[model samples]
Target: MLITKNIKMADVIHMNYFTLSVLNRFGIELGFGDKTVAEVCKIENVDVDFFLEIVNAFVDKDYFPKKQLQTFSVKLITDYLRKTHYDYHQIKVPEIESLIEEMVKACYSEKENLVLLKKFFNDYKQELLNHTNREETVVFPYTIAIEDAFNSKTLDNSVFDLMETYSIAIFQNEHENIEEKLFDLKNIIIKYLPQPKNSENCHKLLYALFSLEQDIIDHSRIEDKVLVPKIREMEKVITKRFGEKK
Candidate 1:
């Protein structure tokens, strides 16, 4: 869908539920009194183009902002990504873990199996936490450094060396592994886990898993399609600038 300035936020959320998360990243609360996208963004002091690009990308998987990368701040992308990490680690994952514990207690027949399932989830959670921490501690700061150096016209040998040593490609590869583990977790629950006596609990677990899977997919897409590519472009620019010096 063409997300022009006139599109209503309510209408956007109505069309695609995932856009709610996107809007939340921008700190956009609902109940905007029938405001257009541009109008709401104006009130929120958000960059209209960046907002459109992100929301559009969420709505359409293939939508990537190649031209917009030139002007967009890597910090903006990283900050949003960091917020998503916090959401997953601090809120969503803990909620699911608590639900699993509740389900285990509520359904005592398959205690052994439930315990194993909980272990699986805990393992996955740890892996995810580590992954996000690496990005926050290492990759994101490096990307920001590149952007800063680029803007300041400080393209030197050290920057080139940093880019060459550690690139976004590594993080992209790690993302695949993270996604595969999540896929396995979902399949294990769907295929092997016995149904809990409390149907409501089972349903809630499935719903949370489904929601988490979709969120992970969307999150990875933002990193793979938007963040990585923009960083790669920055890499190219820096590489060429350094090459000229050599």
Candidate 2:
């Protein structure tokens, strides 16, 4: 079901608990006693439109309103992306690592298997960290700069200089398939690894991996489908305007 502003906030949580993370990213928490999404967002000083769009997108896999999302300012999109990164780095990654560690300690027979699993996950973690680092430090800031330059009447040489060397297309091309390795990691747990004596940790690890995989997929979808296209269009405009002078 497509969540609307008129839907009860608590009801939305009942529908998809995963949205709790989405709500938290927006600085919203539980305790809104039957208030609608709109009512709660208004009280919380959140962008109701953006909230609705993001929540709806997350709730319904088929309902990515890319055009509507693209209408939002780059700052808003980048802010959400940064928050998702925070969730991954500060919460999801460590939780998964801990689960893996517990699983490794849970069994003795599969020590070698567990070690190999650890190595695979460590490599995946490093790649994910590096990927997000590039986006946060380089790609996002560059897009924001393009946004700034595109909106401004005064053309600057710096934006053009940056443009000469980089564009959203370049970033899009370089964007690694970080999720592929993650899928492999999940397969290693599901198909290859022997179950530990305390199988709970292994189960938890698989669940965590699946959750993280979906979260990253959704996050990347926003970037690939919405932000990348938006930035590319902006880049075209800025380059055309600035390229005329130089």
Candidate 3:
């Protein structure tokens, strides 16, 4: 739906179309990568002159440091996860839980419906909680170790290889599992929280589900597109160093 035709850089200074799209979708966009203006222009398919103009506008007026941007593949994933998904979980979990309890209270008179919804909520909570826990306990630690190895020039026996062979498989499998559960839970919410012709609580629950759905989709997109590639790149660096050392 975002057309790329005839939009001048001067018209939308300080934000690219990509940033604008993400901002409109998510309510805010983070900073750009450390890539040069030329590299950004190539990726966005904008003219160099226009891209530079936009960058200069952002730098002059917006005060964003292009040098400190997250340009590298690894840094992008780390930064995106920290800023977006991590923040989403921190805010959404308690908010959604409170609403879920309200839903339980409102639907208590409907014993069967309340019980069903409670069960679904329990499963949803567990799935997301486990996913976050794994990232915190295992994946992130391994990623940090890989980065340390990369930085220290000690690539042999790196965690990067282990993550590539095992951690990634475990994470991807868990993602698929969680995706299935989320799809099931989405249908349950739609069926149970359908827009009431006369009920406000029903409307509230529906909106909550919609927002949570969007956040989950965004979280998964960042993981699949950004995180996995970064892990693989770390693996490549480790393997290359090991070979050179041999």
Best-fitting candidate, scored by lDDT:
2
TM-score of 3: 0.62
Which sections of candidate 3 miss by over 4 Å?
Answer: 1-70, 73-76, 83-89, 156-169, 177-179, 192-198
Predicted candidate 3 versus true structure: per-residue lDDT over 104-219, tens digit per residue: 66553555665676677777777777777777777766766776776775555646456556655567676654556556665766664543233666566556665566555555
Q: On residues 164-221, what C-alpha lDDT tens digit does candidate 2 reach at each position? A: 8888889989987778988988887788777778877888888888878888888988
Local distance difference test scores for all models: 0.80, 0.88, 0.54
Of candidates 3 and 1, the better by TM-score: 1
RMSD in order of candidates: 2.1, 1.3, 9.3
Clash pairs, candidate 3, are 34-69, 34-71
- TM-score of every model versus the real structure: 0.89, 0.95, 0.62
Candidate 3 residue 44 Cα shift, in angstroms, is 25
True lDDT of residue 68, candidate 1: 69
What's the residue-level lDDT of 67 in candidate 2?
A: 79
